[model samples]
Target chain A: MNNTATYHKAIKAATSKLTDIRKFVAKHAREHGFNEKQISDIQLAVDEACTNIIKHAYQFDQTKNFRIELEFDGDQLSITLTDHGSGFDPNRYQRPDLKKQIEKKKRGGMGIFLIKNLMDDVSYSSNNNTNVLRMSKIRS
Target chain B: MKTFKIEHRNSDGFEIIDLYGELDAHTASQLEESLKNLISDQKSNIIVNFRELDYIASAGLGVFMAYIEDVRTIGGDIKLSNMNDKVYNVFDLLGFPTLYDIFDDEKQAIKKFLSDS
Candidate 1:
């Protein structure tokens, strides 16, 4: 039998809400049997995803909200973040050139890159003005 | 407990900024402000000690990217040191090791600053 445990919350898409999001993910990840490092990785990936949604999609509009769902199916754990806003085309993403970024004093456009690096699998989709970022990792 | 905090100290002419707790989108601006204040004051020889930093997101890393060039242009540098493995991994993953100098200990970063001058 594949017993699945899930946790979900609709959090405000604001920077101040990031701490609460991390805490929420850590608790659920721990209950899902993720080790310390795995939990940390998932937490960071989720944070990056939400940060991007708040900054890029919602444009720091705290009145808007986003939903975060964490689910564990057997040894696979998946975290989904959904935002209802105008979405950007992921195909246009450029690998951040750190040197040029520093020279130009650019501060953003690194969240998606970090999310991809921290999660085992990462994907993005948008439907009907709702954008979703799904990140998954196998419990080892 | 606070999610993030910044403390500043001076050692041998190097300004040491101590990072504490989790650093994310909400907290990154505070660190940015600290950096801005230091640079505006012309105290450019900076060393960020991440020994106590429990967490960091891309927003946190972006603060460094935003300021490194300005700091260096003013004839000074920002060296990072004392990062735990997890925190270090984020920087490593982003290729920060190439453009930035990361030291195992705070003293090493300070030493580099002294040597450059």
Candidate 2:
């Protein structure tokens, strides 16, 4: 079997498309020999990232497009999501205070936090009109 | 692919919702609507069983957060039970255990609610 493979898909920035995005990542991860647990981790990280883009960046506008690119080389898998919507600096984002969230019972703001913790590497950058978020995980 | 599903049942005077498949941003609304119906009927003593929940994103987590306050205010509670480790980790990561009553089994969750009354 080839140890390296790449796949890409573009979908509208709608919440309904999150499942397809997750399946896309999971399929490539499974083909790369990632175990069930690892595949779920990768799927979840990608799902959360796309959710953030749809809800915060594109505001659930179905007309906007976000592209997901998955590349698997050997035991490592990297996913890059490119969105044409306005971008935010992920570095400037703060992890929500867990105690406060529980106290106030806030319903959101954990998407980026989960993505960072689930993936081995997560980074964000924007060039011109496109925002890119790249996340990677290694099979263990 | 199998989409998310919620099976509703009643056991020992509590509403049990069995969640199956993946629960992400798209399917969270389905859970939300079900919860709304339950709350509307004044059946807020709820236990969500995650024994078959394959995946859960933050949006799914948000659904619980969105309703807990209302449920509790109406003299009822939303309890979670039977989560696989993967699903539990997501809830634990977000400090949900502190905010919600989570149990290892549906019976225990129902017992807690029953004992509270």
Candidate 3:
């Protein structure tokens, strides 16, 4: 039995497009038998990942393009975001100290943290001026 | 595509903001602008009603974090109310309960602000 569905789209690297991307992911997650909570978590993770690309990689330059691919296989869902902007190693990323952030009243740095916690697995790779971030979640 | 909208009202010397639709990185700026306007007007005590909010992301949560200190410095606070399970779950997952006062009802939040002042 093959229970796999894949979706791919190329969008401008702009914040305005984040909502649409999240909607696309949520719609497919729902169709793949994900519950409300699971869908919301996936939606948030995708939004954060795209936001990082827009803000950090493309610097909100709408001229750049970011490609998003979503794959659903059985009870597992995977999201891959690719951009032709600045890329870094995900392993070197450090989780912010929640207590310190709250005490210092920090405003940002929670995007990647939330992505790591919400998704079951997260990996990043960049080659030849292109960056790819992949995240997966398995429904229990 | 759902857009985010915020409705502002003044009640009992507190600014009550009603959030509607999805709140993500793109729409969080609107909330930030509203908070800035409120602070400039010296209306810091705020009660954000989230009953109608369908979705929220880290950027949406960041807006609250950005202004909380400024509001608190002036003897005011931002209290949240009427968050559904989904919205509340995001806040809770990020450990927001320790940083902000979350209430079950808007009236309760308003009352707390009034009593504290």
lDDT score, candidate 2, position A29? 83
- Kindly report which residue pairs in candidate 2 clash with one another: none
The true-versus-predicted C-alpha distance at residue B52 of model 3, in Å, is: 0.9
Q: Give the DockQ-based CAPRI class for model 2.
A: medium
- What is the two-chain DockQ of model 2? 0.64
lDDT digits (tens) for residues B1-109 of candidate 2: 5568999999878999999998889889999999999999999899999999988898898888878887988999999999999999998887778768999999899
The CAPRI-style docking tier of model 3 reads medium
Interface RMSD of 2: 2.0
**lDDT for position A74 in model 3:** 88
Instruction: List DockQ, one per candidate, in order.
Output: 0.89, 0.64, 0.66
**Candidate 1 positional error at B100, Å:** 0.8
Q: What is the lDDT of residue B7 in candidate 1?
A: 98
lDDT of candidate 1 at residue B99, scale 0 to 100: 94
Give me the iRMSD of candidate 1, please. 0.8
- Where is model 1 chain B poorest over a 10-residue stretch in terms of lDDT? B1-10
Higher-lDDT candidate of 1 and 2: 1
Model 1 lDDT tens row, A1-140: 23598889999989999888989998877877789999888888888888888888999998999999988899999888888887976556767888888888887878777777778898888899988888899988
Q: Could you estimate the TM-score for every candidate?
A: 0.96, 0.92, 0.94
TM-score of each model's chain B: 0.97, 0.96, 0.96
